[model samples]
Target chain A: MNPSAQHQDAEGARLGMWLFLFSELLMFGGLFVVFAVYLQRYPAQFADAGRQLSLFFGTGNTVLLLTSSLTVALAFEALRQNRQRLCQGLLGFTILAAGLFLVNKGLEWHAKFQHDLYPGSQTLRQAPAGQELFFGLYYLTTGLHGLHVIFGGVILSWVLVQVRQGRIIATRPTMLENGALYWHLVDVIWIFIFPLYYLLL
Target chain B: MGKVIQMGEYFRRGFLEPSGKQPALFDWIFSTDHKRIGLLYLYSICTFFAVGATIGLLIRLELIAPGRTIVGPQIYNALFTLHGVIMIFLFIIPGVPAAFGNFLLPLQIGARDVAFPRLNLLSWWLYIFGAIMALSALFGGGGAPDTGWTFYLPFAGETTTNVSLAVFGVFVLGFSSILTGLNFITTIHRMRAPGMTWSRLPLFIWSLYATAWVQVLATPILAITLVLILSERVLGLGLFDAARGGDPLMYQHLFWIYSHPAVYIMVLPPMGVVSEIIPVFARRPIFGYWFVAASSIAIAAAGSLVWGHHMFVSGMSDTAVLVFSLLTFIVAIPSAVKVFNWVATLYGGSIRLDAPMLFALTFVLLFSIGGLTGLILGSAATNVHVHDTHFVVGHFHYTMFGGGGFAFFAALHYWFPKFFGRMYNNRRATWAWGTMVIGFNLLYFSMMVVGMHGMPRRYYDYLPQFTHLNQIATIGSWILALGMALMAVNLLIALRRGQHVGANPWEAATLEWTVASPPPPENFEELPQVSHGPYDLKRAGEA
Candidate 1:
């Protein structure tokens, strides 16, 4: 095939990536719908539970993820300009930011665990009915989002290696584009999670 | 053209010839060729079908007498659970699209492969892995899941059986389903031949396109529902636990949301197949081609919202029931439109009673009965009468098995020569088809009658009043099994020793018929430019 054909292939790959992202949005959309229903059913209890979630850590992680998204986007731009060193540095920074976000998430979850707010914990077992439901949704939604963070971090790391090997250059940048798209998705989901879990209080 | 000369070189090499570097096993297992991957799906799905069929036989035998004849209640519950899981998830859901869609989609579209061939292979591997995980539930833990394939919560969460593993396996299978949808959607969008416009595409491709959308959009809800079930079972989460302020009805809402659309996922491709086979064998341009294609999209869209009809008897509010009942009735219109067009296509045409045509005709009749009975179940008042009765079971089987299952057979026989370059014994195939249809009606129609007389489903032992009909149903199952055996044996023999056939054995007008029987690795010697609709028999005759 010719360069135009390869370009068409790249176009199709981007379309496929967008469709995959739609599915990802719906997966989290299911949880958000669940959260909305529960919040309506127990507004006071949800507010209380929301307050218990550490706002400081949530805001900190949000900043980290937003910055990471910026760096990955910049990495893509660097690759487009054929600045390999700049692209690598930006990606490394993105990975570092993702790691810090996860660490902050760990600290927040640890505090919850210390307070015995985990699902099925003895404290949760004795918690008010609506509170139990609130915490349950909490763990399920945030845990799933955290897994995406880890996946996004690992994918960026792989793209970094591919860039170093000259495979993800300006002319052939589909892999880098997809990786950055994934990282942006992770950041976007955290933006939703931060409000629904922490800022709602 | 340059492409034609390149393909001619490949034609000389032959698709089946293994290169010197790789072993045959590695060549096949690791092959990303869409045709080979399709065949892999065929073999695996058929094996799972056999296992599921045997389990169905056991369930029918146990229902033969008033009391247990073949198994205890506990064993019986497990048997039906395994039957439902294997048949629905493993066999029927992926049956037509994965096997035939993978094999024929590229050929029909005049493309060499799907948009993402490697991802296609990954989907198949995930399919196998999910199947293994599901089967593993049978050996370990408190026996296989007795929560039914629906895995209605409370019981699912409370069951000591291997529900979690089985549910997780389904989660994995959902990934495979989603990826296939993503691949097919992209292929249809990007890979059509130079002149193959959207309006000129075959009806099967249109239906697959609609089915692909459903698979991509609706499957995630099922995935999330399964994950919640697993979480509830393992972590004792209160998501669906009524004791913890969670509503069990919410679980039903989420489960049926995906599953009801999933019914379309299972049947639409087969409907597409019937649409393809009917016009060809009837020797006519399809009646209202645009209408038939549009109805497929209509069905897919309307089908998603009518899911709440399944919850009519679950104590939902009356207003909700009324709304759902109206939507359910609306969804039936598109299906009726397709059936009408199919019947109209057969009018005033020179018809051939080939085996595929026979199954297609059977599909129309059986699917109509299924669709008509669906209205009764769709109504709020009538559904209350026959909510969990065997009527529901019979209705679904008629649609899924009678409609979808027969269409699969039709596609199999119709494409056998094209796929394998050999012809099966037509006389034996017809006989098998006759006996199978007879046995199918005798078995399921009886269940509908008995269910009207108040016989519930999933009962290992029934009242003595239902015994005689149950016995008749069991006998029908035996005949059904016999017919299935004959069909399998005939196809196997033909696969190995049947007479060689040339391309275009049926004198059909589809793009697939224009290619060689068992088409080359790259499909076409030259990509044929489309100048007419898929069913333009007059144009085909001139060629």
Candidate 2:
């Protein structure tokens, strides 16, 4: 009848979540390998393509994700201390940071589209082979990381709702803890991505 | 299902019995019971395996003669591709673990269910959905993908077929696998009953433990690889296209990075099955238990590093090739250690020549032949000679079918009575085993022989010189098919009206047999306090 029944183990949930996160990281790890390989192959052209990205937007988004990571951790800590209101507010801020990060990403992509710098565009078609692949990797890695940010926001938002409803409390904080861990991973990935894509010098 | 109306007196409501609130179909689909989920996988994969096997038989038939046998080249290409996709992802990869592992893991470790039961159900649903998406690619608008299951680009990217949809399906399947692995790892780590230490655990659980790790760690790479293929297909990204400044070898590297460890995910549980069955049938503590357990983990760890062997003839660095070849050879040592341990397990004990034992014994033979040939292919020099040949094909089937596939059947027969509370005709089961072994060896071994004589694999047709052996292999397909059909019929008959069995029909000393046959809805009426190891032969006297 009951699915979990009497088998609830918070430590088990944490272990499961951690293992799931490992899989998530390894997915990105594969992309990093591909990115590293291509960067090796076309170092000069990749730098040229990297310069085409607005460094200002890249830096701004990196800061936004880092701040959001902090907020999520603080939110998790607040939940443990039973400061539900502070936890909710911090989670809301984290979600807001996620939204701003996406907006910045959108504006940056629009700028590239205006320049015909995206994959499959005529401008990219005419570009050198290596630069075409460079933009390709750029869009792929950043786009995937963006998706994770969206997913992370949803998770943190869910935890916020659950905490407000008393479903997630100090006595049972696995959901909040795992949600924060996921958000942190999103930030951690962007930390690699910011330098890997933008700060290539 | 047994549906044994006559055994109403002994019929205890199993996890098989649907909860009373809803329709039976709805109850089964939505139920979080791990045993039910395991059966769901068993049924779904059996259907997929039938489709894959039929396609394989046709492929063998087309190769029976020279050019223009049953289908033309395009159709033949679709045939082999579909066969490989279905068998590898849908059937063999999920075969032992998803079916037997889900059913037995909780029962073996003395848990009510997996660590996450709802998550377990979700994994099954994802598996079914992904299997649908994969199969639907055939009938969908773009026609069947012919880039092969590997889907190596730029062909995969450029193909007008449903490569995108098919790969997206596999991507979803990768998630299913990862979740299953995550669930098993958690269940093992946290849900072991009191006193069920790691060493006292069954070898099958150990193998599943190793397999779950590979599944969690390695399958995500496959997911990412497939996603990259989707990007290339949909966005015209040339990440894997060499002409667009992308390296084709990069795709190979990524694919095998996951796909190679996947071989362990496929075989290790069956090795666990053999390990579990051998000691029980031999009536002895497993010879070198520590060595056998450690070897499963050793195989998993070593298997991941050897993916480059698959890429040797596809063009790779000489130094990378040398290192991968060495690692490939080294991976075999753990497997050999397992084989010798199983043999040593069978030695000098009061061994029963039952059907499960028969299949387990043949698994050692077939897997060894397959594994030994793998070493030959693992060598840089020999691999260059037979890289894409039928020898490689034969070796794969030997390990996959003869090893994993046979052990799956052995597990079915081994645990069939325990799960169904009924026993199949053992003589007929032994006959089925005999038929399958003959057909399996005749089919795969001939391919190895013909492959050694220079027959390239996956060809729709062959030269006049390669015709006879191809015909023999095709005939071997028929025998294999017959054997499979007989085995299926035998099990079906047993399900309907086999002799009712009690708990511990095999007299094997394990936690599962200590409970009622078909088991109670919650596995144990009371939690078991484990003091003895699973196979304490002195404790397990005559039946």
Candidate 3:
């Protein structure tokens, strides 16, 4: 007979989380491939479309996401050291940063809407052939990334609740670590998206 | 924690037993037990299969005499589309992996449950949710999509049908598939018993491992592709619209990028099932365990790169066609290696021509025929003639249905007693198998013949010259349906009234056979220690 031992396998849980992150990377990786293919096919049009996107908003969102990622990472570290208050503070900061990023994104999309740059808008219909494709991809890639941001924020908030209840402490911080890992993934995806859309111009 | 539940009580009460304050039905719905979730998948997938099969019968009826004998062209188009979507997405893709893999992975690896049991339950729920969404398109606005399941763009993008909703439904299903893959991969990697090393792992687990990698890596491409299609239909994104400077071929590339590998997702586990069953029935160690295990990985790897083969007639460059055709041929080698090993395993053994064994043998025969014809389709010159004809249709059905579908039947028969604690009538099972084999070949072989005569597919009408073969094929459909009905009835009766059997009824040596029939809620009272290969019949005999 096998040993009658029962304990939570934190390492296995973390490994599963990391594997899930790999899948997330590849999900976005598919979009990146599409972007790369289309960019090669219509270089000038993509460059023009990229320039039309506001560098101010894109850069602001990128900064917010990067800051959030750092805070989430630090939150896990603080929780590991049993500094419950500091961990909660960092998680709250990360959530705030994510909210700000989405707010900035909403404003940027609204400006695009006002200018009729959305796919199927009258302005896009009148634009050059590749320009429509560029904007189409722009909306899809960033829009998908934004959804991830929202999901990451929600996961972090849940983890924050757990920490507040003392359920996720130094000895039991797998949930905290996994949430941070997901938040870092969201940030990392934006790192790629920022360059592809804003800086590529 | 107050009073321990007996193993027999757990089996009898099922995973639907109430926990804490929850009601019984709610317990089943939210149960994280892998066994309950596996049964959930089994019930839903079989229901979908019945729907798909009915649609298939209607298609045959319409084609019974070359011109539409049943439904109108519009309804016909919708029928075939729904049939393809239901079969591919709801049935075959999740078929073996979701049902058998969920039930057996932890059992085979000697674990209490999958690495993420809660996530496993979530996948089953998502499957149900996605199925509902896909079926909703059939009732309201624009009716079911008329675009073939492939949903080739420009047509798919421009169709008035509710392609958007159906495509989005598939997107959700893809998430379910991805989660299942992730759960299985992690379980295999981290949850093996102390002695179940890689070499000592069953071939079925190895095939599942290969299949899981494919599902994780490839399904996202499909998810993204479907999302793009949704954007195109809903927001008029025009990513694949020709007038919008998008190349329609790019959509094909993205789609088959997942879908071509998806063929493996549909078949590899069944191939794994065959690998598991052949040895047990033959009562021998598999002829070449390493070769069979390695070939599953090889097929998975090579299968991904051969997506371009599907796009041969999509007007890609000649060079692209040449490269893809060559890769397609290369992919067949591993499959051929598996067939060779399977036959070798049966070379000189105490062969039992049981229902499960008969089905496995038929799978080997039919899949070989399917794979060989695939070579004709793989060659650019030959494929040009049979590209969208009934030949391609015949070839695909043979491979998927004959190979994957039959292998699933084999697994069901092979593992039925173990999972349900009941023994079905062997005579009726054999009769069902015989009728199916005859009906299957008659149906698909005629399609291949008419295809060679140049009968185009996805049409409501055809020339008089093809009528005879079409009629024959329709007749074949009747037999196939009859066989399927009998098989379902037989298994249903077994579930309720069949004789109870002990564990290891087949005298197999896998870890599952080491536990009770309809295993306890926690799978093993104490995880059995593994000291040898999964098919060590010598050890099985000594024990």
Provide TM-scores for the models: 0.97, 0.98, 0.96
How many clashes (backbone atoms < 3 Å, residues ≥3 apart in a chain or on different chains) does model 2 have? 0
Please name the candidate that would achieve the greatest DockQ relative to the true structure.
2
Candidate 2 lDDT tens digits, B1-543: 345465475465467676778989988888788888888888898999999999999899889899998899988888889999999999999999999999899888888889999899899999999999999999878789898889988888887888888898898899999999999999999999888999889999999999999999999999999989989888888888777788999999999999999999999999999998998898888999899999999999999999999999887989999999999999999999999988888789999989999989988999999899999999999999998999999999999999999999999999999878889999888888888888888899899999999999878878899888888888888999998899899999999898888888888877888777888778876677778787786675221
In the order shown, the chain A TM-scores of the predictions are 0.94, 0.96, 0.95
Least accurate 10 contiguous residues by lDDT in model 3 chain B: B1-10
Error of 1 at B209 (Å): 0.2
Segments of candidate 1 deviating more than 4 angstroms: A1-8, B1-14, B541-543
* Fnat, 2 decimals, each candidate: 0.51, 0.77, 0.57
Among these predictions, the greatest TM-score belongs to 2
Clash-forming residue pairs, model 1: none
| Pick by TM-score: 2 or 3, better one | 2
List ranges where model 3 is wrong by over 4 Å. A1-7, B1-24, B541-543
Q: How well is candidate 3 docked (DockQ)?
A: 0.48
Interface C-alpha RMSD after superposing true interface residues, each candidate, one decimal: 3.4, 1.2, 4.1
Per-candidate chain B TM: 0.97, 0.98, 0.96
What docking grade does candidate 1 earn? medium
What is every candidate's C-alpha DockQ against the true complex, given to 2 decimals? 0.51, 0.78, 0.48
- DockQ measured for candidate 2: 0.78
Which CAPRI quality tier does the interface of model 3 achieve? acceptable
